[model samples]
Target: MIYLDANATTAASEEVRRAVLAAMQDGFGNPSSVHIRGTNARQTITNARDEVCLLIRGALPEGVTLTSGGTEANNIVLRGIPEAIIVTTSVEHPSVLRPAEAAAEHRVVPVLVDGRADPQAIAEALPASGDVIVSVQWANSETGVIQPVEDIVTTVRSRRPDVFVHIDAAQAIGRIPVHMDGIDALTFSGHKLHAPQGTGALVLGDPEETRLKAQILGGGQEGGRRSGTQNVPGAVGLGVAFRERAKAFDEATGALRAMRDAFEAAVLSAVPGMRVNGGSSPRVPNTSNILFPGIDAMALVALLDQRDIACSVGAACSSGRPEPSHVLLAMGLSEDDAYSSVRFSFSVMNTMDEALSAADIIAETVGKMR
Candidate 1:
């Protein structure tokens, strides 16, 4: 099968799998236990933490806290920061939106398309006395649009020095350069970058300043930011994946962009009334969301699946729903346009030939439906 769903999750790399197996078989002791076996597990976790910190060029290991995935990391930030005014874009992942929705006391500032949270909008939304926690994603999952996070961080810090900026970099971390210079905290998922599932991390600039309250209560782990026995195997695997990917990011990204661009051009030429969503903005290298007018996205997805080409209607977390894409809707697409959107996300494993074949199949399927 030709897999095009990297935005949803990626297959774990061989190196990562090896690392996981080694940890599970030999390093089976509980990190919290005081015995030598436990000490070995604790050291493994610490080594993993240092590797993750290096991925983002973070200075200290104490600021990085491992979590189940991006959702938990986002929740910890939203619920942990008390009474802080929350600012985020309308097009954020549900992970960010849902937690903010649950925090009834916090004020939420909505960012617009053009794929940016306007600094002025944030400035206008801030209250006088309370602290602010601005959550914005570095790269959108569906459209691959890259938000101006550096600019947002600069604006928020200059305008409201007390504000803490948390970036959901689940889609950006290993795929692109993540300079943590201005960011207060950043979240990332392992599965998004060829590591095992159920693994992710939150990197903080100042843990004391933006102290995260524990979302899951139990045995103290992750510096008490998240409580549970450490997933030593998963953590080790994630660290290996990130360190390997960081070495070849630029080359892999270039290949992905080339494939995406070629597929998009072919699709536009082969089919009429096909619009590229977020084409005007700066997007990540590996994704393209295309709209095939008069075609049902769900139907198209099934058709492509029959041809052994895997893709998605939108974010995988919400694909099972019947509703139109919230991301497209936030970008002002009509219900029909939103329903017609299909997202194709590439990965390092995909070849240029496979990309061309996928485009041909897509064009053929759309033609038959039309």
Candidate 2:
């Protein structure tokens, strides 16, 4: 099958799988234990932390707190500081949007039709006084449109330097260039980068200065940020994934972009009136969210799956709900248009031949459906 659902999750690389196996066999002891086996497990986690920090470019290794996944990491930031006024965009993933909505005080900044949050709007959303945290997604999951993270940081800092900036980089980490120089807290997932599932991290700029508090309390693990017996194998697997991707970043970026562009060109040329959802925006190279004017996205997804090709309508977490995509709706798409959109996300594992074939199949299928 040709898997075009990288945004949902990526297949773990062979190296990562092997590393996980070795970790499970040789590093089975609890990270908190004091024995030799335990020291090895602790060192495994430490090495993963270093790799993760290196991948993000200038992230604090001491501030890296491994979590179950992006959802948990996001919750730690959104819910950790309840008293701080939460400022976030409407186009963020449900993980960020849901918790931010639950905050006692929050400001949901609107996005443009291109699916980008306005830096000025975000800056204006900040209060004149009191603590605040402005959270934004580095890249959108469905459309792959990249937010102006540096612009937001600069604008927010101009108004309030004390206002913390957090980024949910689940879709951006391995796929694009992400700098942690200005970001206060950045979260990324392992499964998104060909690592084992149930692995992720929250990298803080300054763990001491951030108002982030621990949501999960236990034996004071993760420096009291997230307390639990760490997943040693998963961390090792994630480290391998990060290190391998970092080495091949340039090649992977070009390959994924080429595949996505080729696929979109073929499909759009063949299918009259077909349009890319965020075509005009600055997006990550691996994603294409297309609008098939008058088709049911779920039905199309099923048809593609039947043909041994995989894609999706929206975020995996919100699939099967029979609702239009919130990301599309926030970008001013009508409910019908939102329901008619499908996301085709690529990975380095995909081939140009597969992209062309998928485009042909999609064009023919859409014609038959119409």
Candidate 3:
């Protein structure tokens, strides 16, 4: 099978798998217990926290709170800051967009056709009182378009120092450069970075000032920000994955970009009227969303699946629903155009040959259908 669904989830790296096994076999005790075994488990968790902190250049270890995944991290931020007005883009993942909708007071900023959030539009959406919480994704998951986060954060801070900024960097962490310098909080998932599923983290700039009210109140783990028995094995695996990716990020990015560009060129050349979504924007090297003008995305997805070439129509969470992509709609795509969009995401394991082959298959299929 040719797997082109990295945006949905990635296969865990060998290094990460080894770390997980080591933790499960030797570090099985509850981290909260007082025994020596427990102490070892607690230390392992701490070391993992340090690795994540290092990845984002966060201030201290205490600011990182491990969660199940990106959804939980987004939920914590959205529910924790209820009183604050939420200013977010409409192109965000459902994890971020759903919570924004539930917030009592919120504003949804529009993204340009290039799939980038405008810093000026975000600035315009800011609340008059300056009591706002701005949430934007570092890179869009489906389109791979990178947002102007640093500019938005800097502009917002200059205008309102007290405003809280939360970034959902689930797709950005391992694929692109992530700096925690001015960011108040950032969220990333383990599976997206080759760690096991059900593992993620939320890094806060000021644990005291931006103290998240416990989304899941119970055993009081994760410094009262999250509660439950910590997943030591999962955390350890995530740390190993992050470290391995960090060591080879630049090389991996370059290779992925070459494959992506080649794939785009092949498809566009063979299939006329085929528009590469978000091609004009600065995107992460691993993802590409394309519009096959006269073909239905769902039908194309089924055809690809039959040939064992796995891809997606949009966000994995919203795949089964028979509806137009909200992200494309936000970027001014017509409902018909949005419904015709398909996303192809790459990973470190994919080769240029595989990408070229996939493009050939896609072009042939589109030709027959059109």
Winning candidate number (lDDT)? 2
Clashing pairs in 3: none
* Model 1 CA deviation exceeding 4 Å by range: 106-113, 315-321
Candidate 3 per-residue lDDT, tens place, 1-370, comes to 7889999999998889988998888889999999999899899999988888766865467888999999999999888876778899989988888888888888998888898988988988888793578999999988999999989988878877777889999999878888787888899899998999999998888767544567799989999889899999999998898888778878988988998899899999989898988999999999999998879999999999887789998543445568887888888999899889999999988999999999999988888888
Give TM-scores for every candidate, taking all chains together and pairing residue i with residue i.
0.95, 0.97, 0.96
**Model 1 C-alpha lDDT versus the unseen true structure:** 0.85
Reference-based lDDT, residue 160, model 2:
97
Ranking by TM-score: 2, 3, 1
Question: On a 0 to 1 TM-score scale, where does candidate 3 land against the true structure?
Answer: 0.96
The parts of candidate 2 lying over 4 Å away from their true place are 315-320
Model 1: residue 301 alpha-carbon error in angstroms: 0.4
Candidate 1 lDDT, 151-205, residue by residue in tens? 7777777777877788999998876788678778889899988989999988888
Count of backbone clashes, every candidate in sequence: 0, 0, 0
Candidate 3: Cα lDDT at 181: 75
Candidates' lDDT values, in order? Answer: 0.85, 0.92, 0.87
TM-score for candidate 1: 0.95
Better of 1 and 3 by TM-score: 3
What RMSD does each model have against the real structure?
A: 1.9, 1.4, 1.7
